[model samples]
Target chain A: MIEFIQALRDPDIAFLRYAMAAGLLAGIAFGIIGSFVVVKRISYLAGSIAHCVLGGIGAALYLQQVYGLTWADPILGALFAALSAALIIGVVSMYAREREDTVISALWVLGMAAGILLIAKTPGYTDPMSYLFGNILMISSADVWIILILDTVIIVISMLFYNRLQAVCFDEEFARLRGLNTRMLYLLLLGLTALTIVLLIRIVGIIMVVALLSLPAAIAGQFCGRLWQMMIAAAVISMLCIAAGLCLSYSLDLPGGATIVMVTGCIYLAGFSVKALRR
Target chain B: MMPQPVISFNNVCFAYDQTEILHNVSFNLFEHESVCIVGPNGGGKTTLIKLILGLHHPASGSIRVLGGMPHANSRRIGYMPQSTHFDPSFPISVLNIVLMGRLGRRPGSFYSRSDKAAALQALAQTGLVDLAARPFASLSGGQRQRVLIARALACEPELLLLDEPTAHVDPAMEQQVNDTLARLAHRLTVITVTHELGFVSRMVDRVLCVNRTVKLHPTSEITGEIIQEIYGSDLKMVRHDHQCSQQGHTHD
Candidate 1:
């Protein structure tokens, strides 16, 4: 215990500490948004959007090569691509309800295709592993600060608009019948989802964003009945997963995001078992 | 003490894609009347309700409610949908469903203490005060229907619209709900779409029958011949047989 305490004083340990903190904060934001995602019955849509982030990163690369933008400026590129994907999904769903899922699938595949082709053509690609999953260690102080600020904004907005969101999720047609501007609310929800996924690209790889968003809330669902409690429980569960996964990665020399997702998968299995036993 | 028309449709027509359903139909729903819109399936009964509630716009006509366009002034209309496809696994309580009724007054606002009190009152009116703490998924069919009615009532609007409220419910429970509607007829204009010809017979002040065209009949004017004219030749025989068994009406 004395040696362990002393080991924490190392500069490497301090850097790892901040990385873990970033992961934990990212997890909380993911969990909070996830409750709504699951309740809205858009789990597949969440997966689609997360996977769709590949286009953003790919666009970032293109911008860096052609526009002479720094690699660090990829955040803006990611946001633009993410928002464009969101807009496409929205427009298709609005005009053609029957073809909504098909459009989403096409967008998802097109994004990945665009990403692979763009990256394949780019020069001097060195950060492949980090893009595939995540490298928490690569996160700087500025990245952590950006995530913290984004998380605060997400939490505050979600809390304030909780009722409108509930109305929209429960029944959009009924919400409209009662004179609520459901179309505007739908747009707002889509924008928020796109923004959150873009902000969380660093801590949880864009590929794994949905898993981090959905798993904790799904686990928390077993323990609570109300929306607010479910959100709180999901946050707590996410914190546990991030902390345990970070520590496990430190001890076992594994990928942090993959380890965290694995821990979440195990917890989900345990929740399933308990549910079965209760039945 | 019959109230004035709170909902009026003038030359109203509607369609889906290129196919028209309603064509220049006109009607007025006066307040303090329990009206049931009865028609065979696919006669655009549900579509009419949606148009009136502004869920869908009329293809060529005007629908006005409470002195304003129906879609623009939907805040004053309370609606209860058919409990046909509700997800039983949704994580909400009966009270929460009922509390949704207050959204009109405090649009996009959080639930205040006053909202809670009003929700409780609505649940109490629908005889679902005891189920306030119960999970919505666990309720029986009739109980769930009542809870939905409670949700609509929580809005405390001047017009209440219920679609197939008594469907899937037992006859005894159906009668109980009919009694509830009768009690509510005095306070607001109530419109229901129902298949329960026998059950709703006593409570409805007026009936609107729709085939390709809509025909209005006062409750006293209802007869087996009129039903046959609207439904077709086959239903006439069924009504003849059923009406013969009735103690109140003479068979033709």
Candidate 2:
């Protein structure tokens, strides 16, 4: 613990501070968007979008290496991929011309396959593991700034649409009857979830993104009786998990993302058991 | 000659992909009238309600609501669904659920003071004002039904539509709901869709029997033959004192 604090202050290890800041800043969006994702029961949709981020990251890396496009940042690639996946999923699920689960599952697998193929074709020996399971310690100062901006955008937009989103999540038919363009609102929700997933990719990567996104909200759902309260509680729980996980990883020489997910999972299990026993 | 009907269906016909749900259905519901839409399951009772709410469009014919296109005046209509399909563990409060009735065409917004006031008033009308702060999932089956009704009322609509309001509710809760609707019937046009014949006879001025087609009869004119026609010969009718026999308007 003492070494971790010293590492936090060390100028040579500024990446530690950046990682910490990014995780905590990203936690706010994680909590808010995750609550909606969980309550709306669209975690499967979120999982697909998160996985598609890899296809973008791989494509961006390949573009930068092959075509010498310096501006094609992987994060930008992730944002593009996530948004595209969200729109396609939103439209397909809304129309439901085909079975929703079949389409989502197909997209989920296709995204991962596309990402792997793109990464394999890239010239340099890039480690997919680092992106597959995130390495938060690699986050740069620029990453922190991007996280901050995305975080602010998410919080503002969510707060602005709190009531409408609540209505959409609760009863879409009622919302439509009330003259709300429910389809548009549903698409907007997907768009926001895409952005949130992009932010989460850097913290826990694609595979474990759903865990971090859902666990805190699930834990909060056990105790809180309101969506806003659940969001606030989830955000706090997420930050605590990230902070503790980071310190534990630093001290114990463990992978940061996995450690954080483990901590969140443990807390959720504990909460679930307590609630069950009380009943 | 007459005040405009709150809802008018002109030779309306609706069909699912291959099956015809409602055929040549026509009706005129006036202002401040309580009408019950009754039929057996799959008899297009819900399809009729959906047509009025503009959730589904008819394959042919015209439907007018509040003197405009079906959905054009949707804001003036309040709707309570048969049952809300939601996650049982959802953390919304009763007040928030009711406040959703005030949702308008705005994209992203908060509930205003007037919206909250209107929601509270609707809750009071449903006799659930004290439970407004409680979690919606914590309410009983009857209370939940009333909360949904309150949500509909929260819109302060001129036309209120309820689908099976008494279904799944206990006798005591059904009584409370009946009383609430009885009071609401005096002010606005109430259209209820139900399978309960007793509810139809007691609460509505008229009954619209739907079974692939539409038939309107005054509550007193609902003979056993009419019931048989609507329900078909597959099911037997349980004649009660409230039932209409060969004798017209039997009081006992």
Q: Chain B vs. true chain B: TM-score for each candidate?
A: 0.90, 0.93
Model 1 misses residue B16 by how many Å? Answer: 0.9
Residue B7 error, candidate 2, Å: 1.5
Candidate 1 residue pairs that clash: none
**lDDT computed for candidate 1:** 0.77
Tens digit per residue, CA lDDT, model 1, A192-258: 7777777666766777777777888888877677777788889889888887877777677888878
Instruction: Give me the iRMSD of candidate 2, please.
Output: 1.3
What interface RMSD do all candidates show, one decimal each? 1.4, 1.3
The deviation in Å at residue A222 for candidate 2 is 1.2
- Best-performing candidate as measured by DockQ: 2
lDDT, candidate 2, B39-97, per-residue tens: 98999989998889888999999999999998788878899987646676899999999
Maximum-lDDT candidate: 2
**Where does model 1 sit among the CAPRI classes?**
medium
Q: Candidate 2 chain A — worst ten consecutive residues by lDDT sum?
A: A196-205
Q: Which segments of candidate 2 are over 4 A away from where they belong?
A: B105-108, B234-248
